[model samples]
Target: VRDVSEGEACPTESGFIADQDRETIVKSSMLPHDSAPRVTSPAADEGSMQHNISELTALCTSLQRKYSELQAKFQAQEEEIVKLKDRVKVLEDREGVAAKQSRDDAPIKGGVSMQGRQLLKESVMTQRRLQGF
Candidate 1:
């Protein structure tokens, strides 16, 4: 590449210089006028990049907070599930006790066979009917 200050001809790949570059010279033929490419300062580019980084950091922090909230909610739900299971176990134990008590309270003489218990029940029922109760 030829420097503009050197005044040396800029080399063209096809050996024929395009007229677009020649038309850009205003007062000094060595410098381009309106057609010069706009240059952005390094500081401005750095500031933009820093802004993007700050936005990303804020987004990451927000996501982390949401994740923590969800994790806490999930833990609470699990604890609730455990508590419900314990309650169910207690209810099942109470039901089992009530069922066992009912069985023990059933009308039947001790040491009686199943057939003797049935005959005793029928006799009692017949006596009840005769007494009109």
Candidate 2:
């Protein structure tokens, strides 16, 4: 290898190499305009967000009240149904008792003690005694 000279440029096997002092600088340019980008007011935006949240909260509250009312109505209807079922059971029991009483009394019709029949016999005896007198 020969000693490099300061006045001469160095040549590589793949041709001349790029100089370190000379570099290709990358730069970009933007268009200048009068108006700037849009900017929203913080106060107005916060007020709108608050109003929307309040509306949603009111809707939720109303829905909660409606749900409570519907649940109460359902419970009342269930209680009413239970009461009606109990009444029906009582009525059926009364009908069974009446049926049993009638069945038991059916065979004792001739052996019945009737006050009207006793009074009729007493009246006939009194009439016979009066006719004999």
Candidate 3:
């Protein structure tokens, strides 16, 4: 083992740090399992990664289902809005027709009673005499 002083360049070999440090730090040639018992095994790491992937996939699936449900609900609400708009239009058209029919059924001014027209003519003649016309 060689001593690695501060600011000193440690020896290296083809993509591997040579055994220079006194501490048993992991090297390229040494597998993680071959290190001290504190090191995590490659299989354990692989299993953990797989577990994380599975959890993510499940979360994605759940989110997708929720999105689909919300989309369907949104579509249904849109359809309901359209139906309500159509109903409003129909009601408005019916109101318009009722208003027109009421106007048509009501008496015209020319169809006033003879007594009512005579009173209007007398009033107009009195107003003309007062104005000397």
lDDT of each model, Cα atoms only?
0.84, 0.78, 0.81
- Residue 126, candidate 3: C-alpha displacement in angstroms: 33
Off by over 4 Å in 3: 1-38, 110-133
- Per-residue CA lDDT of candidate 3, range 1-133, in tens? 5557666566568325334542355464474464445778899999999999999999999999999999999999999999999999999999999999766755457666556677889999999999999
Specify the poorest-scoring 10-residue window by lDDT in model 1.
18-27
lDDT of 1: 0.84
Better of 2 and 3 by TM-score: 3
Query: How close is every model to the real structure, measured as TM-score?
Result: 0.52, 0.49, 0.52
| Local accuracy of candidate 1 as per-residue lDDT tens digits, 1-133 | 6687988876676545455545554436766568778888999999999999999999999999999999999999999999999999999999999999767666456756567788989999999999999
Evaluate candidate 1 by giving its C-alpha RMSD to the native, one decimal: 15.4
Winner of 1 and 3 under lDDT: 1
lDDT tens digits, residue span 47-109, model 2: 999999999999999999999999999999999999999999999999999999866765555
Task: Please identify which of the two predictions, 1 or 2, would achieve the higher lDDT against the true structure.
Answer: 1
Q: Which stretches of candidate 1 lie over 4 Å from their true place?
A: 1-39, 107-133
Total colliding residue pairs, candidate 1:
0
TM-score, candidate 1, is 0.52
Return the clash pairs for model 1, or none. none
